[model samples]
Target: MVGSSVEGLTFDENCQVLSVTAPAGASGLPVMVWFHGGAYVTGSGESTKYDASLLALEGVVVVSVSYRLGIFGYLRDNLGLLDQLVALRWVRDNIAAFGGDPSNVTAFGQSAGADSVYALMLVSDEPLFHRAILQSAPLGARGPERAEMTAALREFVSVDASTSVDDVLAVQKDALSMASARFSPSGGMPFGPVLGEIDLAPAASRIELLVGHTADDASPYVPDQPEAWEIATELVFAGPARQLAADWTTAGGQAATFDFRWRPANAPLGACHCMELPFLFDPAGWSHAGMLAGQEPDPVLAKTVRSLWTGFARNGMAALPSRSLELGE
Candidate 1:
């Protein structure tokens, strides 16, 4: 619970509200709202790992938001996404009270959270935020067909369409496990935004984007199976991100892309999934890098990563020094 004290000040009773971290004596600064990752099955904006206080201290009002998860979040027309939208609305309407500039907002997220950021890019109406950082979004994961999605929910959860709302939540843990096994057609986890076309409503809120994936983000899951790993990575993270970059740039938008190739010494992992997290959060005062190779975070790498992200938020572009961004100019 790194920023537990700061988070407790803003979260709502249901824990669905946004947790904010503001620098002391700040005024009219940029805002950076964050989303957490958990495959849409689990995760909370309240999670300590997401505490962006260090980033907040850089003079921006850093906000980490909580949303509905798993069956509760995705089954009902993607309630979790709606939850995020509501949070964004809240930020748009009230962040100024917290000393944040509503018009200069940067919404960023990782993994499932990153999926939400990417989806938000397509939001056509008066957008809540102006810029976005989509880190490791699995755009290739299509939404399940209505029939396929609900059948598993109905059978495994032991509830029919008319089942009492109370009964839907009574599903057992074992049932969840069973559903996961069947739901994931791809090698990775199955849960994300539903697939559908949303013609954007014209507006001034075209989202400026910065996107990337860790070099070996998907290796752990399918190491032994080369073909599986390649397919999963392409369909889940890498390929779609690149395509989105191309599409956005083609549409005359500034969309910067990168490949996080920082290799940690503790484990054999090579810039694997979630490895870029510590740097983003600037886990200051935290000496150990946890599972990221059991080594102290390299001060050089940590400083560069933070500078890059914060710089992006401040400039609405990937404007960082050469050392700050690995894929340098």
Candidate 2:
């Protein structure tokens, strides 16, 4: 693993490591910092799902950051988001050693990670990165209801700080089950950056942006509930993504948007939540992902996506998806 794999429940010195990959002989290149998503509870920046080597080959430097998650991260505060802030500051001060341009950093992520980037935009007092690329962020994840947080807290109150990490995870799993059962169409995650709990700083209205969602981003999660899928796809992803771009532009910031409509041929899931990831990362890294269905992403589409992403990091603008689909028949 490029960074320390936090795969198992046990913690080690390498748990919160950050990994960097730079092009051969790279210097003064644009840098991209990636935050992986597992609903704020289940991912590691070191996961193979986020291998950035292929993206680095597109003539840029890529850094993947690992942050705290779940009860350890958001049980009482925005600790995960704070951890990311620390990583950004580290990049600002030290990325040059990796042949990257510290001033041209772009903070990018998918799903919950994308939400973290958005939260950072509001809370960061100083500009940590020059640009941001938010992929499928649940911008519509409404929150801070006293009742919901209180209910969530009750689950944690029984957990002792001295409990083993693995035991704590079991408790988290139980809590997640309860939370999932209580989830409604009105978008809000059980564990994520809560609005009222986080003090809102100045808006990062000036940062350039590249934002969008898969055409059918909510399909996979609501495979059995079509109505829920429709509502979640639009309310939780598509509608808010478009609104974020519009608001960015309205705030006098440069922004680019895309609608990824490509899914594997005959993929029942359609272009769901993470459909575009293989195109941005190395398909090999996502080989075991159920969403891909053992299919290889079109290499041409992958190249196009990589180009668009790196182009944005280098110059803050990349051509939007020209057609409804970037791949598939």
Candidate 3:
């Protein structure tokens, strides 16, 4: 898909693994690095769900990352976060080759990816990127206890510090789904960054942030339990995001909040989780709009969101949603 969208494509073999999409003749464009969401057990930077072609063409360099996941990412240590931090360092050092400004970069993610953004922001002592756009971050995830992971691991293999990566992957590939389901009550995700290990440097710092949630973001996750859905969405995604905005603002940082309430026509998923993606990536594109039929997203509305996202990376300020959402104080 990316083959036809840009003038070039490149992958790195260093501490990071990212795909760079460079627009034709684009140079010094602001960079937008994307992180994909998959419950933290599944997903890669290469998922079609996160295509950055249109966004890149609109005047920014796009970098989509593939970070560690599942047990490989968060089991006993924050190895997954280590990979993500390395990716950021790579962008800070190498995005210029793709016409991206090393100093002007924005990191964006949704769901588990959004959770990653939150963790990353909290851990960085200095600016790895100038801005962040978090979508539906599950801040309510409980820290996985090492004993629990060890017990889970023993259910698959006996360990003596002699276990190999192959043994670990073999067990995780088969057991993660079960483990995540078992630990669902602790954290919303199958695996997440552990507490005491996800501390951000200096405890407080201002970062230009654009955070939001779909009005009905939790429907897809808990369609049957309406009451549970509403409460979880607020406590885990919406409420925490609002508090983060308020905290950032209180710390003298700038933040713009949004409520994606655009309902899709003829779709059971109202303005559900990830529903805003079709609009942000490409409202008119067939991949995401196949079901929109007569309910195609407004071109003006799509443009407005695209502009706000890129604008945040470019200028440290995100414009309000077309329906007029306000930036929090």
Q: After superposing candidate 1, which stretches have Cα over 4 Å from the reference?
A: 1-13, 143-147, 150-180, 183-187, 198-205, 223-231, 282-290, 318-329
**lDDT tens digits, residues 1-329, model 1?**
11222233342326586788999887789999999887776667776677688788767898898887665666557677778888888999999999998988998999888988866666435568888888888666554443475556645555556765455556634556665576553314444556466543332137777877877777666666645655666667788788777677766676777777776564554566777787777554333444465555566776777677777788866464431234311
Q: Give the TM-score of candidate 2.
A: 0.88
Q: lDDT of model 2 at residue 65?
A: 89
Q: Could you tell me which 10 consecutive residues in candidate 1 have the lowest summed lDDT?
A: 1-10
Best by TM-score: 2
C-alpha lDDT of candidate 3 relative to the true structure: 0.69
Task: Rank all candidate structures by their lDDT, best first, as comma-separated numbers.
Answer: 2, 3, 1
List residue ranges in candidate 2 displaced over 4 A: 1-14, 143-147, 154-156, 185-188, 197-202, 226-228, 318-329
Give all TM-scores, in the order shown: 0.82, 0.88, 0.80
Q: What does the lDDT read for residue 129 in candidate 3?
A: 85
Q: In model 2, how large is the Cα lDDT of residue 75?
A: 71
Q: What is the lDDT of residue 215 in candidate 2?
A: 79
Instruction: Extract clashing residue pairs from model 2.
Output: none
Per-residue lDDT of 127-222 in model 2, one digit per residue for the tens? Answer: 789888899897766533434754655665466668887777888787777776665532235676655544222453557887788878888777
Instruction: Write one digit per residue (lDDT tens) for candidate 3, span 14-48.
Output: 31467888789889999998887877766667655
